[model samples]
Target: MNSLKGHPKGLYLIFATSTAERFSYYGMRAIFILFLTQALLFDKELATSIYGSYTGLVYLTPLIGGYIADKYWGIRRSIRWGAVMMGLGQFLLFLSASMLHTPGWAHGLMYGGLTLLILGNGCFKPTVSSLVGQLYTPGDKRIDSAYTIFYMGVNVGAFIAPLACGYFGETGNPDDFKWGFLLAAVVILLTIVIFETQKSKYLLSPDGKQLGVLPDARQQALSAEQAKSASAGEQSSRKWRNLGILAALALVFGTLFYLWLGNDWVSVGIFTACLVFPISILLDSSLTKIERERIFVIYIIAFFVIFFWAAYEQAGASLTLFAAEQTDRVIWGWEMPASWIQSFNPLFVVLLAYIMPAFWAFLNKRNREPSSPAKQAIGLLLLSLGYLFICFGVKDVQAGTKVNLMWLTGLYFIHTMGEIALSPIGLSMVNKLTPLRFASLMMGLWYLSMATANKFAGMLGGLYPEAGKEKILLGFRIETMYDFFMIFVIMSGIAALILFLLSKKLRQMMHGVE
Candidate 1:
């Protein structure tokens, strides 16, 4: 049952599921900060911080979700549960918006909704991504191209989300935001219905085995025993060592949370477990030398990913603010919604996704393709260029004067190109390089990088110049928007240069995987 140009039937199913899920997520995100500021009356700093914390936790929880899928729940069950949770979350947000006049209740409902969304995203994001990897066999050349197509599905949802959600949410009185959240819930329910109906027919491996089915308890125990024997020839001792590590990590995190975050035990516990689980895996005694090298490459790339995402994810926070406050968004005598700018990246993605795989295929045929690391380096360079374009375009603009919309649109185009070069490629890289036994867990670790980046993005967004407010960040006085934009230009440019310089060494560490 080949569909989508000879890809497996399951590929399209995953694509649909991913697309709908992204629609739900990006739709809410498109108006989240604006809703906070305009409807809830939160300041920019507070809204950005909440945005950062919400997104950060959304990525962070995937570590636990992925581990559960790997060990017990399996991908299918995890995804279903995640969809339900996210639907509930969206509904809560809808209720929150409905109660906009009731500040206390609305605030509580909003936080509760955010928490559920974070948890649901953890379960949904990594498992679905791992399943996509499962659709192809090891060493399949088509995997990269398949991820590219899947990523295009992601952008399809992202592109439509703001246009649909933003229109209803932003066009009317501020109180109308509930309709958008309600729409997101409806779309997510539709996604669940589609997947539940079609999965039995289409979601299968190449060998015709059902994908994402959990093993029986007996089989799971056997596999656990095998892993223990492989690790140190002593199951009990290894279990104790792992438990000790977890306990120690919990204690450390608990202390930190008490001291720094006003005793936020939930955050402490979740982050502690996220950090500890990966360390335990990396310390496993059974890894082959080649496996260790490949894993090390993943870690190195994950480090660089933090920088990449820190800048790229500004689209949701700082860039959104810029669109609302600085960019001239009038089109044909009507002022466009600020969230409409959120659509530009995905629009460029839809355009470029078609061109990129063919470009890479051409390079491959001629034996001239750049290594994945090199492509990622180029992506960072492009990201820097995007920010530099904004910096230069806004250099002379005054605080009250709106810059041309082209500046923001052009920046999104360049950033979209950068994203195409890096984001899907990074997903493919993790799937390709991960040991099969740790597939979901490793994917979770990959998202952990995003977790860190998102938190940093929030911090950066907080630095965005408020009207008539000047502040010093990293010793630079950000009196104008240009100064704020230049920080990203400098940061991403240096990161790109460093990555380009180190690409050769990183490629060597891949042990010929690419």
Candidate 2:
């Protein structure tokens, strides 16, 4: 029995808690915009802005969450509090969702609900991600594989949430929408209960037993290694005192620079990160040559990943709306829900994530496995092609009319193909490149790029002019939406080419670290 127990009980606890929370989050998020527009009668632009801001804030807060977890409350207690906040948030969301069409009260409830959710997710996201890191031993090979498995859990929850909950969210029956919100609340409550029940078995001590000391076997060994390295002329640990001031400086610098851009503080801060952190790393001489080179390659990979997400994120912002108000969902006299279209990316990730590793293994054996950068470049190209299909397909439909759901479906397939090539691999790359000391921080930085990309996607999505006459190609007139897709395709194609040119040099920089 002991031999079978290789992984920590804490890891399973994290998974269970995360799955329930993701279910609740995605369940609501998948349909949130449509709920705002259709149910609350907000203007399209206002609703889009609201949704964009909500999601952008969701990604942005993990910086604070990670900090608090590392310094004070720690993952287990933080997650416990997070689960409560989330449950409350879901109930508030239900209140809003149920009363959405009920005039002035609805708007107040909506704002309150959004606030609770934003705060709850802030606490939840970073603690969970860090806890996953805590579960493995130092230099454990299973660690990376473990996260990949956990990543799959996230997508699995994401995949199922929309389809099952989306049906209720947008059902023709009014009761179903209310029921959906209520069900979301229930899911969050259950998550809280489950975690509480298991906490003693897993995380009786949320913080380490010793103040300012490491907790697990992994951290114990890590401290020993650090001692040896320091004896061998490495400098003493960068004390906690310096990190806060540095991070504060970065935050302040980022804030001042981006506040002028828009009201979107998150959008500005993270783009500034994509600029600032890598530069700061370069200027630091304390870093090992290996660390500097590895981080440099990581930055280039992050850049390409940014391009990939800018296109993929369209599934929620522009693409979902297009499906709802525009796409001809009446196929065989059945009206498919627009939010359901959002489900495909997660669905594909769940089914195909495992398969791709095997495919890579086969390709590696044949000496045909493309490098990570090459795979990501290919992902960008495929995403570009997906946008091309959408650009053309939108044109093939009647003006001011809904297009076929099949077009969206086809586009998702292409997006998924691209995702398989790059998405999981990107996580693996980040984990590989990041030094253990800065592991959590680097992961936070990678997500910082995602946060920015998401915001940028929305900002650019808002750029599709409502009344522009667009160009035609292949006997189809490209509307504003199509033109947008074309722009993305061209943008990514150029990026992919540039990255491919630098691919060899960047690979050399990695020095086989990955």
Candidate 3:
């Protein structure tokens, strides 16, 4: 128990489960774009579109899964069923890769596989995260440390997946991609076995009660009423009113995003959901003023988070392209696979994970630690700096010459620091601020922000400069790699500054939680 920074045994159990689940995900993701463009003969634009839509939907479905877990399936059952779906999804991807020459079957099977993955992730992601928070009593200082340890567990898989998957799938021969997908499927099977066998023994509350049991609706409603006095009729009316507002906002946002995104339904759906869900949470009749304000903090931080992830997630698209097309990957005349570069950020996270938690704890003990939102603002700042650092590396390179690999390694290192500041802290903040009844739902909302950011990431990746192809955003041209990288610098930097200004108020809203 002391091994994971003095966390509960259940935390490590969750760590194991999440490690295997992320292995399945990041393993497949490490090679997914390559599969689309190389084996299926799709162009870069089409492949990025598919990648964006798939990743976006993967986060978006957590809303559904969260609702179910909160009301029906409960956490443990959700994990098991979700794992099965993801395992099946990976198997389908393996079949799709195996039949790459048969374009019809390959395309169909790929879509089928991606659908299961999206739905499955919806079920798996939020519940497991909520489980981590549930392992400790509320207001436990170690919650942050526990999540950091869990985050390292996640990165452990992320670190290994690319090395394994990229090696098998990114070989010059297209047919070999199936082996990577097969390995992913196998990992998901392992995920199921580990969680099912261990959950009863280890996934328990501090007082020794079995956790993740089905939620009691009447008890939840009564608890909500206790938080704020509201008659049932008034609550019903408020719920309807919120639903109506959500519908109207969705329609308006859907139209705007669809127009801006050029008829992409995926972008429209993601953006609309991101805008509406938090507002829906705010309008809940049962939330006290304090609860509502704290929830607003989650919303504010989540908005900035979109900027961070949109810039960070270039790892999958434009960055991968950069690694493949512009980075020097030779070691003694043997070229490395581009996808292996995906492991670097996660590698940095695993290396720095323990150090980060202790650093924060030291500051906390000294009464000098920043609030959650401030730390996230710092994350955005570091993200911008990371891109700005890399901008110099590519500024003067000739069209055909590649930069050294250390440039990417340097960029990933800085970005990993930013991720450490933002991602796990955000998870812990959500856990600390939210009411118990809304735990999974709020976590789902957190992932919904990622859904929007990933869609934006896809859109941004489309702006990657191609030879003789003109790309423009907000009247600015993207012609050089430096120009493209600077976009993130400016975008994230401004967001960080704005968030810094608001950090004090957001901390006030937390109302002593910190």
lDDT of each: 0.86, 0.69, 0.90
User: Using TM-score as the measure, which candidate wins?
Assistant: 3
Give the per-residue lDDT digits (tens) of candidate 3, residues 142-225: 888888989999999999999999988889899999999999999999999999999898888888878887752322565643
The estimated TM-scores of all candidates read 0.94, 0.82, 0.96
Cα RMSD to the true fold for all candidates: 2.6, 5.2, 1.8
Error of 1 at 282 (Å): 0.4
1 against 3, candidate with superior lDDT: 3
Candidate 2 segments exceeding 4 Å error: 1-13, 101-104, 133-145, 172-178, 199-266, 273-286, 464-479
Model 2 lDDT per residue over 446-469, tens place: 666666667667665665435543
**For this target, which candidate reaches the highest lDDT against the unseen true structure?**
3
User: Worst lDDT window (10 residues) for model 3?
Assistant: 216-225
**Cα misplacement distance, residue 165 of candidate 1 (Å):** 0.4
In candidate 2, where is summed lDDT lowest over 10 consecutive residues?
A: 208-217
